[model samples]
Each structure stands twice: as C-alpha cells, then as structure tokens.
Target: MIVLPRAMMPIIVACWLYYLLGVVVVGQYEWQTRDAFDEIRMRMDKVNDDNCQIQHLGDLYLPEDAVSHLPDIKDININPVFPNRTALLHLHNMALSRSFFWSYILQSRFIRPAINDTYDPGMMYYFLSTVADVSSNPYINASAIYFSSNMSYSPSYRGFFNKTFPRFAPRTFRADDFNDPIHLERISTRNTFTVQDLGAFPTTRLSDDYTTDFYRINEWYKKWLPDNVDKRHDTKTTYQIEIRYANNTNETFTFHGPPGADEYPGPVKWTRPYFDCGRSNRWIVAAVSPVADIYPRHTGFRHIEYPTYTAVSVMEMDFDRIDINQCPKGKGNSGPNRFANSARCKTDTTEVYI
Candidate 1:
C-alpha cells in the first residue's frame, strides 16, 4: 500500500464517504422502483367484482301499492341432469363470454339514444341490429336463440306484448302456441269486439290461460320448475334474492328456483344445463346477468357503489351446437418417414426382426 500525507488523509476519507452515500441512494431507489412495479402488476392482475354486489330497490321508498305492482325478475332454475365434463367446461366458457357480451351491450353508447329520449322505435331497431351484427360469429353457432329483457314499463314493448305476443303462462308444452302472429291477431280482434258481441262467442277455441298480466305469469311459473329436476318434494325449492343497499339495509325476495344452488345476488352466473320446453325446446345452458342502473340517493344525493336491478339479460346456447371432442381428430396416427435412400438405425437392437 502507498502511504499518503496526513493533509490528504481527510480528503481521501471524505471522498470514500461520498461514494458510500451515492451507493446507498442508488440501492434505495432501485428497491423503491421494484416495489412500485410490483404494485402496478398486482393491480393489473386483480379481477374486478364491481358488478357482483346486489342493490335493494326497496331503498327507493316507493308507495306500498306501487311497490306491489312492480314485476318480479325471475331466475332460471338449474337442471339436475348434469352434462359431461367437456361439455360443462365448454358451456362455462360460453357463459363467461356471453356475460361480457351482454355487459358491453348494456353499457354501450347505443342504448342511451333509445331510452334516454322518448323510446325511439328506430333506435330500438338499430340497437337490435348492433346485437345481431356482433353475434354473427360462426363458432358461436348463429342458430342459437336469444331474447332481451322484458320491459313492461316501455309502451312500445307493452304494446308488442299485448297485441303482437300475448304473455301466456309457462306450461309443460305449447307455451308459445299463442306466439304465432295469426293467433295474436285473432286474440286482438276478439278483445276489440267484446262490447259488440258479448254473448255471441260463448265458447272460444283458444285456452283461457293466456293473459297480459305479469302477476298471473309469475304465479304460473311458480307452480312449475324446469322439466328435468325432481319436483317430488312437498315444499317447492325457493331462491332468496337479497338486495343490499348502501345504507346498510337489505330486502329479500323469494322465488322458485332449483334446489341445492347458491343464492344468485346479481352477478354473472351460469345456470345448470337444462332442457327448456319453451321457445328453444332443446338442451340448453343460460348465462344470466342483471342489467343495473345507478341512481342517486334521495336524502344525500350519494351515489351507491352497488348496482340497482333494472332487468336481467339471458344468453342461451344449445348443447347440440357445440362439439365437445377432447382429443385431436388424428393425433398419433401417422408413422415416421422410412422410404428415404439413407439408412437409419433401428434403436431396438435387442429384439430380432421378423
């Protein structure tokens, strides 16, 4: 080691201390930067459950008579007949994709123009066109049937249901018998001529089960469950839909649903694959999600974090449309090429060739 003069010793010590401080500063910065990056990564990976929370409409404080008039949003009953594992996975993925699909549509810019102003029929057509255009994927099986949420509040939809498609009670068969346009027109004409010919048509061809009242419709559905499930139990299986408000208050509505299933408190959920006798009349699975509307509270104008239920949107897919093949079509069928002029060694030397 080279000896330094006593005057230069202080300078060398000062320089060494400065170098140490710089190293410590750099190390701390790197550590802080690493921590910040980790935080950002975690935020990116976090799954959002913002729409999963339930909202109670009772908190709105409507009159008791008005509240009683509100329609009950029904849930799809789960089917007891379990699908194969591959089919179940396929359906689950389909349900997830549909959940996103409907969610995007509900929050899309197109819906506001339709309902924001006085229910534009032209806007309704455009909205439905958008839905049809987006759902034109080949893999999704274009033949799959879908229906929008029932908007009894809207005059256009109400007229459509009243005159075009009369609401009928859910039955074992022919729930949609009156859905035919010809039948609907006949029914409308019969209602219109009620004052003129009261006693003339004493006996009618159609069943009297059909009605425009939603309350009657709910009662009809409550009497029955999905076709495949066991309805033998004395007590009907009911699912409690609990709606919690931001004010720490909640109200529950009990409706008939499949037994042994968890409560569906407003979220993207998959119903057990079931054979729907109505409309589709095939083996189907449904993805149901609630269409929510944010409302400002009456007292404080505070915005609730939970979403209030406006309507439930369902996306159905038939099982027949999906191919549930687990393996590749021709995996491991071909042999290695052996017709080349160059000779290759057979690795199995222990065995004698035939």
Candidate 2:
C-alpha cells in the first residue's frame, strides 16, 4: 500500500462535499418542477370549474322569469333575443374565445414562473376591452361573470389594472380621434395596411371610442387610476377593437401607431387572440422600444420585438353549419369548423344557481 500525503485527504474531502452539494441542488430543482406541475394542475382544475359554471349560465334562458331576474342576471338586456342556430354558433365561438383567453392567463400567471418580466398596464386594459366586446352578447357576458370572479382572485391581475393601469395617462379624444381619413393616413404612413389587417378598421371613423366610452361606463375604474398621472404621451396607451357575434362569441383586435410616428413615442404590443397568427384570428401591432432606452421595471411584461407587427387569425366558421355527428368523438374533421369536435367542447355551467 502506498502512503498518501495529508494534503491529499483534504482535496478528497472537498471533492466529496462538492458532489454532495450538486446532488442537493439537483434534488431541489426536481422538487420545484414537481411543485410547478402540481400548481398548474390545480389552476387548470379551477378553470374547468369556472368554465362549467359559465356554460350553465349561458344555457339558462329563464324566459318567464327573465324579467324578474333582470338585476340578478349577470347580463341583463331589456328585450333579450333568444339564441337561434346562428346565435348558438356565436355562443360556441364566444365560449372558445373566453376559454382560450383564460387558459392563457392561467399558463402565464400560475404555470410559468416570471422571468425577466415587465408589466404593461395597457395589456390589462386591452384585455378588459376584449372582454367588453364579447360581453355585448348577453350570453357571453353572462358567461364572463364567471371569468371576472376568477380574475378577481389573481394577484398579478389585481396589481396590473388596479394598481398600475392608472399610472399612464390615456389619450384624449379630439375630432381627429374619430377622423378615419386622418387616422388612415397616419396608419398608411406607418405602412400599417395589409390584406391581413384583421378588419381593424371596420369603418374610417371611430365607431367605438374606448377612452371616453369606457370611462363613462366604468366610473369606478376612473377613480382607480392615479389622479395626477399624465394622460398624454404614454406610448403604452392604445386603442383596441373588439367584435362579438350574436352567439356570445367574440374576438379582440388591437392597433397602435409606431413609436415617434405620432405624439405617443414608445413601444407598444397587442395581446388578445394568441401571439401566433397561424393559431388564432386576432391581430396586434406594436412599436418597438428604442435599443438604447432603458424601460422602467415591470413596465411591459410581455415584450415582442419592436417595429414588428403580428396578426393571429384563427379560422372561424358558423357553428350552426357544423355536423357534429359526421365527425368521430375525438377526431377533428378537415375544413373551417375544426373546433366543432366534441373533444374541444369544454363547458362550464355551475355559475347558474336555480
């Protein structure tokens, strides 16, 4: 046997200690991944529950008692129209849209850990605008009551709209705000027009003025924003267009001028519909942030490249035309109504009580 130097023993001990530490670190990482998975599962379950409740509410007609229940109903229209086949189709579309939105929210908020995150209050405002668009359909709005309940429980969401949204002063409406010719000229100057514009300009005029109209409808929201905050010159401020069909189905579209192209000079990004156009029917345009500029922390949580425009246009078909029987239970048939398969038909109806 050869004798070893005493110094060699310390080296051996140090190596052993390092190996142990590595094992401990790996173990901790494994545990964290498992925890993340479990949390995601729980959130998914809650979403499913909320979805079921929303579905139930949508299915409830309450024709005889509808008048008496007006105040209690989540979406109360004075003279409500019963859903026709087209309307049912609309409902299906709306449900799917809402489902997609909430699913994305769950993935971002609970499933994924925040990494190099920036918060943009505009995104939340856009989300609200999207929700409002869908809510125009009474059934869709009724379904959304369930979603609002769920969102109220989220901390990130609360921090976004309740705390941060008011910090950026929004744009004021002038005749130019509704002036489509000037608006179109501005948009054209920025090279915003394309076959894939996703119907953002339904008309040349401001058919819907979100800034003024939204404040009028949601008085409480006005007070939620800070009083001293400057409403002008916030690049994050945006104008969004949301369209909902009679079925309570909807889509949200967003548009913003490029940074330095107009009075507002800063980066802007649109969300609502998915980020990938191939997967969705929504469109978004954003001005890229300057390369050298330092953005405030937690300013824009979801960032895509600047000077980049992306549109997501998910093919939508009239749900009534779908022949549910033709397609097998789990397999999707080719053509427009690919989403009509029963496998994708996830419903939530528990929100309707009696």
Each model's lDDT:
0.31, 0.29
RMSD of each: 28.3, 27.5
Cα lDDT for residue 161, candidate 1: 21
Error of 2 at 327 (Å): 30
User: Among all windows of ten consecutive residues in candidate 2, which has the lowest summed lDDT?
Assistant: 285-294
Candidate 2 residue lDDT tens string, 1-354:
989899799998999999999998887643323332243234324433224323332221111211111111122244343333334435434433433343233223322344523232233453353445333543221121111111222234432323322112111110112335657644322222112211222334342222233212212122121122243434333334576879998867443322222333122211111111121111111111111111222235444212111111112222112222223324322322312232322244557678
What is the lDDT, from 0 to 100, of the residue 130 in candidate 2? 41
lDDT of 1 by residue, 1-354 (tens): 998899999999999999999999887643323332243234323312231112222211112211011111232333222233334343334433443343343333222344332342332442343244224432221111122122212224322222222221111111223444768553422111001111112234232222212212112122211122133322323334566779998876443322222433323444443343313334444444443322111222233312233233344455445423222224321212111112223434586789
TM-score of 1: 0.28
Off by over 4 Å in 1: 1-116, 119-123, 126-135, 139-267, 295-306, 321-354
Clashes, model 1: 0
lDDT of 1: 0.31
Off by over 4 Å in 2: 1-83, 109-112, 116-354
The candidate that achieves the highest TM-score relative to the unseen native structure: 1
- lDDT for model 2 comes to 0.29
